[model samples]
Target: MFKKVLIANRGEIALRVHRACKEMGISTVAIHSTADSNAMHVRMADESVCIGPPPAAQSYLSVPNIIAACEITGAEAIHPGYGFLSENANFVQIVQDHGIAFIGPTAEHIRLMGDKITAKDTMRKLGVPCVPGSDGAVPTLDEARKVAAEIGYPVIVKATAGGGGRGMKLARTEADIEAAFQTARAEAKAAFGNDEVYLEKYLDAPRHIEIQVFGDGRGKAVHLGERDCSLQRRHQKVLEEAPSPVIDAKTRARIGEICADAVARIDYAGAGTIEFLYEKGEFYFIEMNTRLQVEHPVTEAIYDVDLVQEQIRVAAGLPMSFTQRDLVPSGHAIECRINAESLPDFRPSPGRINTYYAPGGLGVRMDSAIYGGYAIPPYYDSLIGKLIVHARNRELALARLRRALSELVVDGVATTTPLFHALLDEPDIQAGRYDIHWLEGFLAREES
Candidate 1:
């Protein structure tokens, strides 16, 4: 067990890792920016360090500042909660070189899975189904056209280093290919500093399902099940649920094995997610997130496991306390991202929280770092919290989530709460009949 661990991020996830470390009888050091001086995570941590100014590039994402904080606090390990440096292979290598353990997968696996094209190829070779596309990055327009022709007309150009759909473009016909290709390349270069892009057959309507797998860094792994993250807007997940309504028991078992085996094959460590696009009983690999996810709570609620704790144990070189046979989904769980944003327009709202009251009851969980008198900085992502609920079944889970949402309150700032309230009334959402595009279309209809 580690004597102390430093959290190299801010907000709910940093607090999340802090809590997990405390439970393991380990102390925590929190690193925050100047804007987050009064944030809840910093207030609760055993020690807090101000890394830099408000902007993420100068603070949260600054590797030198984070490493300095760890050195000052004598932290033996670092837990990068989700974003920032969570998936940065270079950061992982640097931390290892400094003799500090990074609580995630190896740098090799991170680099391998970080590139979309390379991840698809690796998965394909491991017998995991991947979307039909170029074997590697499409280097020329001719190669893009050839791959698009073979994959059929409606193809998508995606950045090799893309996530959050920033570097993705769709072409419905030959006339749209060149424009889409150029746009994807430019966006990819601007966003990820990589101009490489790839082509793939685009599925018009598909559910975004991801399997949660944990590895012990020694080729042993187990899966907790899957999350239906189809309710997304602008390629960013807004709502997520565990024990996908569409995946049957047999399909769940099959895909779970595939993901677990893939992790084992790569000798991956810690918690990771393998995302897929499912349509008509078939799943095509999309990409793998090689770190703890924001929606990991839903999986933990249903599987009765603490993924953060597991990641810590794995980093400490401890064998898993539970095995595959011990894993089982006991109930349905759903999570609503509670972002500090306005409704309909969905613009970011960052300001003082005059009043704050989070819902609480059996089977309800609220993960947040905001409180009354706290001012949310405008520079970071708008996400302020996550509201999750669990029940014996999907119907009961939805009912509980709705009730919890109604009880929640945040004053003096606009929030996306109204969006969830509106979504609850939709028949397709209630029936679990929506795909990845369904939420975007729903929002469009509402705005119109």
Candidate 2:
């Protein structure tokens, strides 16, 4: 076991990792930017290091500064919570070269899954189903049109190296293909510096489902079931829940086994998520995230497992504490991502929180790093907290979420809490009838 680990991110997730390490009797070094000197993670960590100025490029994403922080603090490992450099393959290699353990998947696996086209191709060969699309990168407009035509109309053009809904354009018919192809390529070039693009038959009302898998990097792995993340806006997940309202035991067992077997074959290590688009009774592999997801808490709640601790154990070459048989998900869990943003427009609202109060009681968990008077820095993601609730079933979980949301309070700046409150009142959301495009339409109707 490592005596100490350095957390290479800020905000709630950094604090999330710190707590996990603390429980395992491991001291933590929190690296922060100058703007985050007063952040919660920095305040609670056993040791703190100022990596650079406010901008993420100069601080949280600075590989050299992060490495230097590890050296100065004598930390043996780094747990990149979720974003920033968590999935950066180059950073993983550099960390390994410096003899520091990265508490995630190997650099080889990261690089392999980092490219969209290669990931789909690899999954397809591994027996995981994928959406009908281009075999590889379509570099020209004619090639894009051909793939689109073969995939049928209503195809989606996506960047070979895209994520977070960027570098994606939808073509509903032949007339829309040229513009969609050109726009996707241009966006891909600007966002990832890669002009490559591909096409996939777009499933109009598919549900976004993902299976969480963990491995020991020795051809052994297990799956913790699935999370329904269909509530999304602009392709970004807004809320997530375990034991998807639609998926039953038989379906879960089937897909879960397939994902576990696939990752095991590749000797994948640490935490990874195999995301899929589910429509009707079929599942299509969309992409695989090579790092811990932001919605990991809901998975932990249902399965009663500490994923961060498991990540550390695997990185240190320790055996996983539990196996597939040991993972018996007992309850339903839901997580609402609370962001520091104004509703209706969803614009960022960063400022000092005047009053902060978190919901409490059995089956309720609040993962946040903000406090009263903590000035939220505008240089990072607007997500301020995650409000999660667990219960014996989805219905009970929904009731608990409603009560918990009412108890929560963060004043002086607007928050998206109101959005969740409104969602709770909607019949479609209550019955879990929404799909990936549901939230966008909901917002559009609200605005009109």
TM-score, per-candidate, Cα-based:
0.99, 0.99
lDDT of 1 at 312: 92
User: Where does candidate 2 stray beyond 4 Å?
Assistant: none
Model 1, 276-364: lDDT tens per residue? 99999999999999999999999999989999999999999999988999997898999999999987788899999999999999999
In model 2, residue pairs whose N, Cα or C atoms come closer than 3 Å (at least 3 residues apart or on different chains), thus clashing, are none
Residue 338 error, candidate 1, Å? 0.6
- Candidate 1, lDDT over the whole model: 0.94
Model 2 root-mean-square deviation: 0.6
Q: Give model 1 RMSD, 1 decimal.
A: 0.7
- Error (Å) of candidate 1 at residue 155 is 0.3
**For model 1, the run of ten residues with the poorest summed lDDT:** 439-448
Which candidate has the top score in lDDT?
2
